[model samples]
Target: MVPASTSDPVPAPSPRPQQEDRDRSSRRRQRSAVILSAACWVSVVAAVVVFLGSGKPAQVTDVAGAITAAGIVTGLVGTDLLLLMLVLAARIPWVDRTFGPDVTMNLHRRLGKPAVYLILGHGALLTVGYSLRDGLSLWHQTLSIYSGGDMLLALLGSCLLVLVVVTSLVAVRRALAYEAWHAIHLVSYAAILVALPHQFSAGRVLAETSPQGVYWICLHIFAFGSIAWFRVAAPLFATDAHQLRVARVETLGPDVFSIHLSGRDLSRLHVRGGQYAIWRFWSRGTWWHAHPISFSAVPTDTGIRVTVRASGAGTRRLAGLRPGTRVSFAGPYGVFTAATRTAPRLAIVAGGIGITPVRALLEDRDLGPGETTVILRATDRSHAFLWDEVRALVRAQGGTVIEMLGGRAAGAPSWMSAAAAHGQATIHSLLPDLHASDLFVCGPAAWTRLVVHDARAAGLPDGRIHVENFTG
Candidate 1:
């Protein structure tokens, strides 16, 4: 029942419905984005105001003094950027919904280097400035600063911060285990705590009685509170109430396995299809590696399943887990579900094991017959992990399915097979209603981008296309 045929004349659209519903949702997202961006920038501006207005802006009478004044400025701004970085990583649901987790993580990485550099420059410039004012050598000034209040702990914190950042760089991270990297990154919390004493005790602008000081203190509280509540307290509460556990594990295909989890009060979970959760398995060897997997089917009152391809070492450990292995989860996150649908028609493209979310969506969404089409891609027939399920659903809904096999053409900048490329098959070729349909593409990021490129080339509006890369 692999109804693998879509080579036919296209059907015409029936009378259209109003675009108000889609437009309204899109507008709300736009407004939310604007508000979040403006708030972040506003914090930066307020930090500058507090610094300049705290006292008569220090007049630099000499080069050494000028360097010192600049150092102060950098210190204020660097701390501001660091605070922003903390907020980005706090996993706040509102922030995640507004800008997306991927976009927020990208911003976190982008701000890291510059924030650290500014802090470094602040340290260097102040060392020179203070040394000149005191008629002491650089080494003597450094020793003197370390001897005075909280500087030693700050120095140690800075070293740990540097280590965290260096290990997080893309090249260095590839060599480290996810668990190891995460352990190292946790040191960032200690670094931030230790670095705080010197800022409050040493810096002139953040003196305890000052307005700037109050604002800065509030910023720290808000940042720490967001992380503690969302990443810690909320998960703890949810796990206690739900009592989630592994019910069974089934082999789905070659090297693929599905973990069926059962829990209580799942309706309170507020989950949707096509969304994923971060699953932490409480097994002897696998307790530390939290796996991100999407639902293969929409959850029931007490049951859910997450399908995984056991390629990585961490994933391979899943098979040995005994029934009733306790499970803790963080979310039913991601915006690639029905909420992203902007049209009445649906066209989905999924590759390899990327079919997980798409399969869930197919089952969850209310698509009329002939209102959807799907293109499933795999390296071969066996790799098409859920093709039968897809075939059954698409056929039941009167939607067409096209199964693409084999690798891309030699030296070709395409995501399709050699045969399809030769036949001039494009997104529009497989999906004749491409312009009117909401297109969902899930795969490796690079291959997903190529599909998006094809859609864009055919002049499809960006809003009509949705992309999901399984980044958890």
Candidate 2:
């Protein structure tokens, strides 16, 4: 059963829980993000410091030396950026908690091109420097570098890096299936492995005895170790701990269903309401694809539920899942939970299939009577996946549930329904206390943005608005 029900009204609280608790969690997340962001910048500055302290700048007496020094600095900064990318993509719980999964992955993607450019600059600068040093052509110098020491492996690593970056480009990425794209992305790990040996063998600056060398070695250890632990080992441990399997599947509407998962010690997953997990069902048709789906209901010790829409081939196969089909997941990720609350009241806006996480949020026990308001938008009654459950929960909590049904009205705010738009309804009109409440928006990307724009236009602080778009 869902955590909240119409049959059981929430017991009224005395003046609500102290607002300080909510403020404390918000401050903690902000502090954590600041500390983590500072550390990244410090690491980059230290890399440049290490390069400068090597006396390389003083040694740059000629054009060749200047180019060589430039190459080394670029290489150092580039490597630091690449490692930062890995750590962001590692899905470390602390990082995810601080930055949210969407922000973290977005940062990861943003760094890819610059990291590639810097690495390429390192190679190009080094090539020109060496060519000038030996009075050889760029081609001959390139051949010489490739033939010497660990340069061959470095060259191979560069090629792999290029491939990974190219495949990640939006145009290229969209052309390929997720499985194919993911397979190529995994090659980045191999690239890092192949690229690493060259650092010590080809450059003395990172020799084991130096302070710079020790710093870099530890950084590499931390970066790769985080990926191994959080991305690989942690998920494996969660899978083993829960041993999750499909207990049942209930059809909610056309193309929409809820997968009920049964597992051992499920509460150990520490899932927060409004968070999602990347699920991989161990079935012939669905095993190869992993989906990020929000929890439809909060978890108990033995069970959890995730709602899914058959929008693609991978998700369509979820309809055929049998009871006891093995399931493994890698989350409880995202920060769209009660812990993010920054205000005395909670306001939620969800559209179409986006209601899943909102359903889970409304079930949260901390939400007291008269402290929650939900606006669920859909084109029609059928499109409103779990509105009834949401309305029931809201009613029990002594809150409000507003339904917006119909397609968009022409020349109206894109996020609003025809009637609501025509009535001149806005976020402020619908949510009078928006400025004094934490607004959580979940829906299709464009529509979510429009809702967010309306909230912002209504003078809501950015920090007071939390969003989870359906698209990556």
Candidate 3:
């Protein structure tokens, strides 16, 4: 458990292997999703083409036939794609915990572009196919079938697509306030509702005339139902409407505060040590918005505790909160945990308020005698929140805490230099035998990158290093 010096410059963690693994996994999932989506669409299109090309004579009965055919195909494909998007969004939290939210957001943006394109194509095909068949204006054709209910649904669906496109655009989202954008985005559910019935009634392959129509209809209904429940209903119900109340607010330092929350009716929030929650202070005017904060304390009989530093607007608001303030927590999400990886030695690095999660990890009883070392970097020793608490906890756990004050420190400190020199010293001593140890970092992105880089350069495997981002 070698102690790192404040002055000892650590290299940036090598990103090659970690990045490669992440990229490879992302590619595999994307490929699988794309292939599945493509196959489903191709099958639907082939069925439509076959039905149209069959010996059955073309019937120009009304605009309904063309609209129905196009709607059927488009709805099938569009719905599946939407389902995939929901699944991806649900799984994204875990990915973000592993690779950082920036990476997850980038993937979300890329994947969404294709989904928007598919939706546009679906709309275009429906309009053109119906307009050509009726010899009427697009608007008139749409209105003509309004009495049948499908047209009304289609209009609503179109509106939803427009919302999705507008909100999804980076420029538009940036221009609009986050709250406004998020509110408009919530209309997505309404769009799904509007498009659903029309899809069921007008779909070709799922219609009564087709051989496997009944089966397909049942399958689609089941899939859509399940998706709706998992993606929306379950989450809403998971936490009771009664917002969490702040049981305690302890100021660990000048800008850092630890908020302890408890609610009589709140359900148990299952979460690992290194996870975070998006907390919304219900007393605030804008209760709809939530900000992510790492958990500084593990779950106990009382409730959950989150240690927050007043870095920005949301956090500042939180810092001002007094005891008994009502709040809503949206998650205990992220995959970073002590149980996920294995190593002979464990090194934890944290910067500023990022020590919250690291504190939780150190406090975990499950982590046995694995030669643990914690390095807390701050502008000054006084700026280190919970410094004494962390040191005490580490001492009790038989781990070591290396507090690096930001100013010029007396020749790098004898203990730090000794630890860096040997690498593999016991918790009491500073020395170098620490090579090949597992490293866990939670801090500002720059500090995390630096510590991780140094650890890797010192001969640590990619899998031996784990990092969690608190900023994003």
Candidate 4:
């Protein structure tokens, strides 16, 4: 591992064939990720098969009976989707490694509204279907559902689920404090609990011997068991084994600082460069919030370092933390490292504090001369933190570095400055071997997306482009 503040030169890289082999391993992981995601959908499809093959529906004696029967099918499908959502959000390690934390989280986000919509449709259709059958008004039918066994609790659960989804919406989530929002979101467990009784009581399909019943029971056990083992148990065990504590803290630039931590057998954590951890400091004003931070330096036998910029109250409190404050982490998550590389050559484009992980990536291993290239982006010269140290490291490896300063070129959609974009400063310009090199980008969401667009326009394949955005 490199020192916290250093201008020392780097050594040469390892062999090319080794990197190629690592790339192949990454492709295998990608395939596994696809297979796992497909399995989730397959499970949903199987539930539908059980419903149809079991002879569970009415004989269509009348129009009202048919409507009510369709309602049952919708309810079954909705419940299955909700279960899948829980499994996806369980933070299973293999799933996180295969798809990346960001990719999995994005997938988890996409499933939210669809699952909730299905559930809402299930409730409304059932109300209408039952009303027609009983010769009751729609309002009376809803009242009827509430009056039945476990029906009131199930209704409450549905309402709570709706509130959880509403609070998770982008605009509303932004307005609430993270802690406040998390508290409300935890109510989802109660929602699931309250809704379970009705499924057993109201089922013709979910009897003990039914395939549907057996599958759902196993699914619920697996989902909650995964959360227990990976999310809760594993973190607690790692925290105790590491016994991590702050050893030193140093200010790097305005609002930015590096935290040096000491712990037992640190490297065994298996954290890679360009990956991040959710850090919780055991201290007043800091312990409640877990900040996602990247390692600024590689982990050593006894210590590690993470760079943080004070962008929020949680982070601002981090800057004031004292030595010996205990720490716990929940990651080493992300696939932005060289293990995901697909080419012999490497190119890095870093924006502002995004340089933290990029710096670690550079130091992760030795780089052969001419094997790497870098383009450092900043609003201006003063905002270019850690440039001196980076330049020294790149010079040691015979790599190239381009410092692009200022906003978008001519206020256009380019990531380079106006003068640079007009000249030889596009993605192709900086990385002459653009299509052949693995490009790693880290930055604010919008800026990173623009750079990725430029890379795609230059004909870089999806597999060769790696990106990390600070936003969740």
Best by TM-score: 2
Residues 1-472, candidate 3, lDDT per residue (tens digit)? 2444423323333333444544566465456556645754665465445455543326535666656465545545555555444444553443444544444445545555565555667666666677777688888765676546775776677677677777878788878866788778656556666766665575434455453455455545654665566445655665565456888788777777888888653336656777777777766653656777888877774577888877656566676676887776556676566654454456777777778887777776443332566777676666778777778776665665676654322453222223343454332343143563567778777657766666665666776677786553
The local lDDT score (0 to 100) that residue 366 gets in candidate 2 is 56
Collision count for each candidate, in order: 0, 0, 15, 3
User: For candidate 2, what is the TM-score?
Assistant: 0.95
Ordered from best to worst lDDT, the candidate numbers read 2, 1, 4, 3
CA deviation > 4 Å runs, candidate 2? 1-15, 204-206
Query: Which parts of model 1 have CA positions greater than 4 angstroms off?
Result: 1-19, 56-63, 204-207, 470-472
Give a tens-digit lDDT track for model 2, residues 1-472: 0111223333333455557888888889999999998998999999999778766699889999999989988888988899998999999989999989999999888888888889999999999999999999999999999985688888898899899999998999999998999999999889878888888788754566677888898889999999999888989998998889999999999899999999989888888889999899999999989899999899999999999988888999999999999998898899998888888888899998899999998886456777777888888888888888898888877887777888888874578887777676777778776777899999888999999998888899999999999952
**Comparing 1 and 2 on lDDT, the stronger one:** 2
The digit string of per-residue lDDT tens for model 1 on 1-472 reads 2224854334644534434566677788889989998988899889888877777366668878877877887877877888788888887877877666778888888888887788788888889999988899999999998885678877787788788889989999989988899899888778878888888677744466688888888988898888889888988888999999999999877878889999998878877678788889999989888887889888888988899988678898998778999999888677778766777788999987789999999988766657778898887878888788888887877788898888788886888887788777877778878888889998888889999999999988987887788531
Q: Write the per-residue lDDT of candidate 4 for residues 1-472, one digit (tens) a residue.
A: 1011122223435566767687688779879977998897898788777777666564658777677667777777777777777777777777877878888878776776777777777788788888888889998888888886788888888898899899999899999998899889878768877888887786544446777778778877887787777777888899899999999889887788899999999889887888888889999999888888999878998999999888878888888889999999877787888778767788899988888899888888677777788888888876687787777777787887777777665656776766676665657756777776889999888889999999998889988899998652
Model 4: lDDT of residue 376: 87
- The whole-model C-alpha lDDT of candidate 4 against the native structure comes to 0.80
Relative to the unseen true structure, what is the Cα RMSD of model 2? 3.6
Off by over 4 Å in 4: 1-15, 58-60, 204-207, 407-410, 422-424
Better of 3 and 4 by lDDT: 4
Q: Tell how far residue 219 is off in model 1, in angstroms.
A: 0.6
lDDT of each: 0.82, 0.86, 0.61, 0.80
TM-score for candidate 3, please give it: 0.67
